[model samples]
Target: WVQKSLDVTFEEAVALRQAYLHRYGTTLGGLTAEHQVDVDDYLAFVHDIPIERYVRPNPRLAAMLSAIPLCKAVFTNATSEHAWRVLRALDVADRLEWVVGIREVDFNNKPRLEAYQRLLAFLHAQGPDCILVEDRVVNLRPGKRLGMTTVLVDATPEEEVDFAVGDVLEVGPLVARLLEAQND
Candidate 1:
């Protein structure tokens, strides 16, 4: 549905989804309300894509994440099953102390305060100090707004987020610095 309506490639579809999120709170809800598109078909199309390519293990990243003493969690709009699959594929599932997905949180997705609130509650964490790492600038915006320290992975210059890095591979040194700062 989204692919057909937007006439975009898979990458473009992801970008469009992100753009919609930036413009509206929810992609499916926004498309349905604004374009009168069928949500089921859009979801089906999304599920049709091969996710394996997008998910792969990064051992270096895993090591870095393991070094951080802060409790780590994954907050994603994807279903818990999907998120777990990706994490497992990435070989970092064990590093994460918690996994919060749309299904687990009553379909509340990122950019929504409810999702963040629920994640914080589940982690017994306070706002503002907790860190959130994401690949999308639009997704990082809400984290910043909620006072979390936001890091943008694979972000572009226009994003202008608090911290930007090329990939998860570079996160180790940064996390080390954060740990040093905390100890200091």
Candidate 2:
């Protein structure tokens, strides 16, 4: 798909995608800017993941999220529909209150200030009120800079977040601990 869309060989497509990532923070952003690709069409085509094959309904995760009273949302560069599909597949669609996608921020993606600014404004919440949970250190940087208590999922200890968890299941306990600490 990437090779055909970029009109290049597989190897070339990989390199081009990397270049775009470095230049635009996202291949979608670069494709839209340089190739004039339609955002909706490109996203739909690229993000058509077979969620069921890779992700089964996680009842444990659903239970954990339900136990937490925080206002949950998925802040992603992917389309809202894609996020929704993943959440539903995980049986946690009802857990999140919002799916902040690229369209929601007018295509300003993560690791960018405008994207976070726009999303926070939409939620009527400031950075301190948000606890950003992400796997990537780069994505968590902005969240930290904006005063969010970042949680790095499936990662080793890092400077980017306040908490680092080896698995998503640990997040519930971590959040509960944080709340307890705050009350203390």
TM-score of each: 0.73, 0.93
TM-score of candidate 2 versus the correct structure, residues matched by position: 0.93
RMSD of 1: 4.2
Q: Runs in model 2 with CA error above 4 Å? A: none
Q: Model 1's lDDT to the true fold?
A: 0.74
Candidate whose TM-score is highest: 2
- Candidate 2 residue 23 C-alpha distance from true site, Å: 3.5
Against the hidden true structure, what lDDT does model 2 obtain? 0.87
Candidate 1 stretches with Cα past 4 Å from truth are: 1-19, 31-45, 48-54, 156-160
lDDT of 1 by residue, 46-121 (tens): 6665667887887887888888877788887766667777888889989988788766666567777778888777
How much is 69 displaced in model 1, in angstroms?
2.5
The per-prediction tally of clashing pairs is 0, 0
Give the per-residue lDDT of model 2 (tens digit) for 1-184.
6688768999988987898788778888778778867677788788887988898899999999998879999889998888999999999999989999999999998878888898898789999999999988888888788899999989898965788999989999989998998999
